[model samples]
Target: MPTPASPQRRIGVLLVNLGTPDSPQTPDVRRYLNEFLTDGRVIDMPAAVRYPLFQGLVVPLRAPKSAKIYQQLWTERGSPLLYHGLDLQKLVQEKLGKDYVVAFGMRYQNPSIEKALDELRAAAVDRIIVLPLFPQYAAASTGSVQEKVMDIVSKWWVVPSISFISTFTDDPGFIGTFVTLGKAEMAKREYDHVVFSYHGIPERHVLKGSHNNYCKLGTCCNSYNKNNRYCYRAQCYETSRQLAAGLGLAPEQYTTSFQSRLQSRLRDPWLQPYTDEVLKEMPAKGIKNVLTFSPAFVADCLETTIEVGLEFKEMFEEAGGEHWQLVPSLNSHPQWVEGVVNMIHRN
Candidate 1:
């Protein structure tokens, strides 16, 4: 008789999202904000300056109000972002089967990245693949996730080979999912125009990452190429381009903008034409009925649900707009789950 050989080690798949507070409570929101804001990549400032500025002033002022928004955004399943991530994890796991171990984690709060990595380590995976949920590559989002993963994995005596899917800004499956969602919405009404809005980062961050000072952050982003491959603004425009083409939108039928900026006392520029400002100005231009897309987010978090879906809708209506339709994010949509599985296997 011969002893049976052990099965080969499985690969690990970790899906990471930006995260949410533990609860809608003010305390939980404050704590989450503190951890999120203090990250060096996010603040892009020295610890001395970042801590005092964020902790002393920003978090305290922002948390309670943010908590109220979170309260509105919360549902029976708790945070939509977390639950959706979990749903996607389960679907991706089922699709990958026994060959891979899948886990979900958030960058900031509960089910933290450290815990997710621990699960992969416990599974004794041979290699780990990290997929940050952000489509566009930004130092503040995907970069932070990658850096944190490295910091944790470096501590292990025997580290597994790790790879990251940095950006899927132009992936067909990702674009297709958004297109399907957009088509479904567009069928319901004849919108006057379309707007693609992405999360805004500081202009300085874009300048810092610019290759050879090529990114003026204006017309430079109108065309996407290797020179601005990792440029967040450029990638965003690229996403918009693919999505617009998919939805059968003519170039004149759509426009791009940035949203969800921080209140910078210094008036530091962030990526723009701002979403709110654009919506406000559109009615006067006779673009009253509009369709909006938030491609930067794959899930309906506070930014998508409360800010754009609810808040922006109200703003547009107040500005004399007739119909404001926000195409929902790809939250555990079948296509998106399929896309995630494809992304995992391809990487």
Candidate 2:
């Protein structure tokens, strides 16, 4: 038997998820939105442009609507995303044994990155593995978390050695986990169409991040090159392809798309076809039953629950499609929890 090391070096694993509001109330949602949207990584605009637009327009206009959606998705245990993150932390700690410490934080709101880092410091950890749960890297998601981690630790009197996993979009373990879930769902009922819908970003934002001209907002992403492979749109498409291949899905049976666009006039083109548009057109394409997955998020959130599960259901049904099922997120799934444990050790 392999014996465990004595005095095993204490290590910290910080898992970050996109944040949620403190409460479902409008005020709380407004505050959460303010912090989230104002991040330069999220909105990618100067304070002169983002602040007034957020405060004067977005907060007042969006909070109520967004709050209503949050209300529908909130549970007795609070936001699903936050609660699932907490559960994953507990499961990872159990899997890693007593030598390693695990902690979780939301990138935006309560249980902030600062608190997570402080806990790691208190544990006297010699090294830290920072894992942002965004499977696909985007300036608005994974990049924001990286920026915040550096921002917070820079002020600390003592900082531990840290490593961050920017994206695991193509991890075989991750793809395998999703394939298992997809097959289980398929067994229940074979759907006519499958949609791999990811979160959307403005076209300009993607180009600004892309180092080359390869990502021209089309099927060019179907074939990627080293220079533009890091592009968010390209990565998302590649994720869809890998997951589809893992599930043995054919090209005609599935399609890749983007969702949750805030506005139309942001000027840069976003990934397409939009989810709502797909819903309206699927019936004509003889797509009566559909399966959708939100690979962008590792845990269930307002976007996955209310937006995809509820809102998309209504749109699909209204458009004359029969069945629309959203594959549940990999929240605290045993294999997924194991994947996290493996990732921490590998890091």
What's the TM-score of every candidate structure? 0.97, 0.95
Model 1 over residues 83-184: C-alpha lDDT tens digits? 999999999999999999998999999899999999999999999999999999999999999999999999999999999999999998899999999999
After superposition on all CA atoms, how large is the RMSD of candidate 1? 1.4
Give the least accurate 10-residue stretch of model 2, judged by summed lDDT. 263-272
lDDT of 2 by residue, 1-347 (tens): 99877665788999999899999999999999999988888887899999999988988899999898888888999999999999999999999988889989998898898999889988888888999998888989988899999989899888889899987888776777888888999999889989998998888888888785656677677765676666898888889989989888888889888899977734655667888888889998889999999998889998888889989999999999999999998999998998888888778
Tell me the TM-score of model 2.
0.95
List runs of model 2 lying over 4 Å from the truth.
1-8, 265-268
Question: Where in model 1 is the C-alpha error above 4 Å?
Answer: 1-6
How high is the lDDT of residue 170 in model 2? 87
C-alpha root-mean-square deviation, each candidate: 1.4, 2.9
- Model 2: pairs clashing at backbone N, Cα or C within 3 Å: none
